[model samples]
Target: MGMAVVTLKKGEGRLLKSGGMWIFDNEIDTVMGNFENGDIVLVHDFDGYPMGRGFINTNSKITVRLMTRDENVDINEELLEKRVRDAWEYRKKVVDTGCCRLIFAEADFLPGIVVDKFSDVLVVQSLALGIDRFKETIVKLLRKVLAEDGITIRGVYERSDVKVRKQEGMEMVKGFIGPEFPTLVQIEENGVKYEVDVKDGQKTGFFLDQKYNRLAIQKLCKNAKVLDCFTHTGSFALNAGIAGAASVTGVDASQLAVDQATANATLNGLSDNVKFICEDVFELLPELEEKGEKFDVVILDPPAFTKSRNSIKNAVKGYREINLRAMKLVKDGGFLATCSCSHFMDYELFTKTIGQAAKNVHKRLRQVEYRTQAPDHPILWAADESYYLKFYIFQVCNDR
Candidate 1:
């Protein structure tokens, strides 16, 4: 049989034309020829102009994810190898390769799959059906590509156990892709060591995106009283402790996370200065405020408050409340580092909310620096979803 062809509706494909990878179901006028879901298909404009090639999955609203704009290039093992090599090469140039995001799905032009390297272990998350079929191939290719640099991959694990996989018509599953090794992998970033649990830890076992953001706070922490809210595994708190913070208090709602974070602190021999407390930040912040507690440096690294647009209003409220409280907690002329990981909470909105919070709390913020996710998670311009994290550092001052 000939290749299946997907024709875009008139005036559709705007996002695709601008270099995005997704083609929504509503954008496609029709599909001609025969092919199964997850099969490679040819894409065409409304007037039958050849557009590109992509994998189509009717199971997803994102019907097609373009692999290439060139209609002539064949999608084969050679192309896959090239994609893997290019991603690895880019990381080698831009960020530390020891433990970083190797492939960031659409940002890397691979679409629908993310691979994180923790030390020698590789954790893969395949979120789309079309990419699910090629996960093993990509992993093998990545292993081969890394071996070229004399880097041996000890093990590979799958962490595709996300609810979004159900939307893609795939069962959520995770397990060792190859011979099982120890799940807890040790990695060092900016002189801070972490034991990443690739098998059961959150989101491929760690948040590698904040690799540099955590480093940015080091200088401001020396001999400073530091408070790290939502300190999962004590990444930021430990960094502060390492930077010679006078004292560090890290809080998280999860006992598991607090235990892990406490273990990490002990692992670094920072248990004396850096401590983990199991408490809801929302509750603890107010309680600490009531007791007139203050810190020279306050870090707010909460999880995504809003995952989708529908709940953005509530997310804003959550962000504003925590930021206001954090500002109150920071001593005069001290630093506050706040961030939002929700893509729905765009930069403009997040900044506006922070400003509002500062005004309400009678605090003045002197902008220090603005940062995003580490370069390893490159933000592809047209793919807005690739750019989720927004971090800001500011010196909080009481109004004169």
Candidate 2:
């Protein structure tokens, strides 16, 4: 039998019409077939014009994740292999294939699946039951696709232990997808070496999205004293050290992260200049201010303050507080690099929050540059979720 059919309400699906990939459950008018959660289904409008084909799940708010608009396209091994190959080829042309986001879920047209390649290792996170069915196939296809380019993936690991799985009514799972080897993988990026812990580290063991942003801030650190707040695994501080900074202090609340960051500094032979401190940045920044401490460069790469829309107000407060304190800590005429990783804090809201902080502190923010995630994490227009990261560099000066 052919795939089941789905119909959307009138005036709904404006997002899909605008090139987005998701269909909200509220937009669905009726489901006209025996399709359970995670089953491939055909979608159509109220008038019965075909919209697309996608995976349907009653368990998730995103009822349908459209796979392709072409009705003739079949959902099979051939299509899966093509998606993997197309993603790889796009990455090779735009990003360094040695380390990058191989598949960015909806951005790469493979909804609910994320694959990151770190050297010879691939880490995958499949969210929905429908998408999870194809996780292994995607990995095998990816391996074969890379083999054509003379690259061999040493191992594949699954990082599906996140809570999003529960929303989809799936079990939390994390383990090796194939033959097990050392989970500790090493890779170099932006002239710095990192020992990525694929088994237990945060977000696929490393934040590949900030690859170039780290390199952009390094230019302001030559012979300077730098402070990197929320320095997960010490990427920013290590970059400052590699850029010839006289000294670097990286602070994180997680002791495990600080310990691993210290190890990373040693691995890169940068222990002499780069150091890690296990402390809450909020408390430490105030203490530094009380002691009249300042730095030539200050970086704030804090985690997403709010993961959901309800917490956006508090998230703005947090971002403003950190940015205000960080601006005060920068030496006169020096530099500050700051960013928010949450899409709930949209670009306009983020920039406005920063401006309010600058006003309250009575500082002049000379905008150096505004940047986003590297090309590997491509932001699809109209798909607001694809565009999350917002980065900025500024020179701080007293309002004379």
Candidate 3:
């Protein structure tokens, strides 16, 4: 007959009512019309009050991802173009567009898709089945939007290889979306250079969210000895070196990442002062402590300790252990920059974990500054998952 309608159970859709984008499968009461899993359907409350419109995926626990709050709106080319243009415009104003996240999924009102710009290349990640159908259209629109500003997109790549795709009943796949170009895309940020491997690198090649966070440590690193743990691709360590750190040692367990970080250091002409070491940070931290090694500044940019809530307890312990060891390695009055990239590790819990670490090591922390992800990764207030990066800089002081 007409478009399918989805009705939410009574007292459900609480997250959607509060400006969030997801409607869980359990929250839906009934389906009124036949539709495919990825079809756009009308959604209403238990009493038939129209809620909004979203694409439905029965296979996903997050059944509906609302595309709009307006009952009259249609999902079409015009709407997609507007979304693409709005995301690009916002990035041009708030962050360095040379290399940054152009669209942060639900945060940009385009749920289940993320697009990143690295110089002349664009990387697209489609996480939901509903959005996968429109992925190509969004990419074309984005290319056209950037072209209007005289920016030529030489290549477009799809990195939809994340495990979450399986949750949505889709295959994890990655390859060139159009004409094949070199997968190794070189770009610059904060006066440092990097080669991003879109075909293989983690999470769309690089972490653009830490852009300004890397810049934040420059002044403090000048002429100081620095340690960068979990230094993926050497973003922080290279930033320290470029800022004239006397010496910078970057550590990561991945040999590929270490090699990439080493190449990046050479690209920035900081090879002599900046070095990459392939070692497990946990084991190395305690070894450094035993050796009585100290640094003027220590940076801990670990990968997400917990991807799900089920593992949060262990994540807290991991965070506490690393922070405690890093604190012990920091000279008195030295700077310690730490962060948690997992949304499961919320701000309050992460802060408390770090506090516990400092106390366990008998060290006091003088708060210097607190920051979230760069504006390009805007934290939508009600969408807590969009606000993952929690960064804090502190002065670690030994008890007198």
Candidate 4:
């Protein structure tokens, strides 16, 4: 049988027409010819106008993820190699080559595949059916591309253990891609060192997207007493210590995370000034407030409060509460570096949540700077998911 052809319902390819990479099941008018799921198929408008070719999965709500918009382009080894090469070249220009996100799913034109480089190790999370089929090929191509730059990846670890994999009918899995090497790898960013645990850590072991954001915090931390909440591996806290902060306190609910963060602090010779506390930030914040604790800089880098729209109300409450409590802990004229890592929390809503928090605390915020994830995770204009992280620096003015 010839390749299956998908015809869009009359006026249903609006997203595809607008350069978006998704074709929902409801958008299709008909599936002509015989094809297996995950097979590459041609896309056409209801009037037979060629749209492009993509992989279709009846199991996914995203029925089709466009691979190539060019009718002449073929999804062959040559095309895949070029895509991987282009992604690597882009990272070299936009981020630190030592550690960065090489391919960011749809943003890099490779839908649903994320590859992060940590020192000479690569960690991958393949999140979609179409990309899953090509995952091994992409990994091989990525290694080949990096080898050209004198970067020999020692090992690759798969961390596709997230529940989202189930949505695509994939089994959650984690293991070494090939011969196992020590899962722990060391790398330096902005003059600070870290031991990233690629085998088992949050979201591919390290948050390379915040490389510059941590650096940005350094300039404001000199001689300041700092508090870094949700300090996973103490990245920001260590940065504060390296910047000559008087003292830095890093808090997390996970003892494992706190231990790792503490070890990372020692790795950077920052142990003298940086301390990690294993405690729920929600509970710790109230106790600190009760103690009349104050810090010259309070950094709130919490995990995503909500990943779905249904929990947005609860997420907003979480954001507002932590930010308000954090505001009270900041000394007058001190700084607040806050951020949200949930795409569901849009910029407008997040900013408004913070504004309401400040208002609730009767505090005036003197804005300093607004930022987002590093350029390594380039945000595509039409793919809003790439733009999830929102960061803001402000002077918390409590003139009570």
Model 1 scores a C-alpha lDDT of: 0.95
Query: Model 2, residue 301: displacement in angstroms?
Result: 0.5
Instruction: Show where candidate 2 strays beyond 4 Å.
Output: none
- Model 4 C-alpha lDDT per residue in residues 1-400, reported as the tens digit of each score: 6778999999898878877889998998899999877789999999999999999888888999999898779898899999999999898888888889999998999998999989899999998888888989999999898888788889999999999888777789999888899999998999999999998889899999888999999999999999999999999999999999999999999999999999999988888899999999999999999999999999999999999999999999999999999999999999999999999999999999999999999999999999999998999887777899999999999756
Q: Residues 187-303, candidate 2, lDDT per residue (tens digit)? A: 999889999999999979999999999999888999999999999999999999999999999999999999999999999999999999999999999999999999999999999
Report the number of backbone clashes for model 2.
0
**Root-mean-square deviation of candidate 2:** 0.7
TM-score of 3: 0.99
Q: What TM-score quantifies how close candidate 4 is to the native fold?
A: 0.98
Q: What's the true lDDT of residue 398 in model 1? A: 100
Residue-level lDDT tens digits of model 1 in 23-90: 99999999999999999999999999999999999999999999989899998889989999999999
Task: Quote the positional error of residue 73 for candidate 3 in Å.
Answer: 0.7
Whole-structure CA lDDT of model 3: 0.95
Q: Rank the candidates by lDDT, best first.
A: 3, 1, 2, 4
Clashes of each: 0, 0, 0, 0
Clashing pairs in 1: none
What TM-score does each of the candidates earn?
0.99, 0.99, 0.99, 0.98
- Candidate 3 lDDT, 26-107, residue by residue in tens: 9989999899999999999999998889899999999999999997899999999999999999999999999999999999
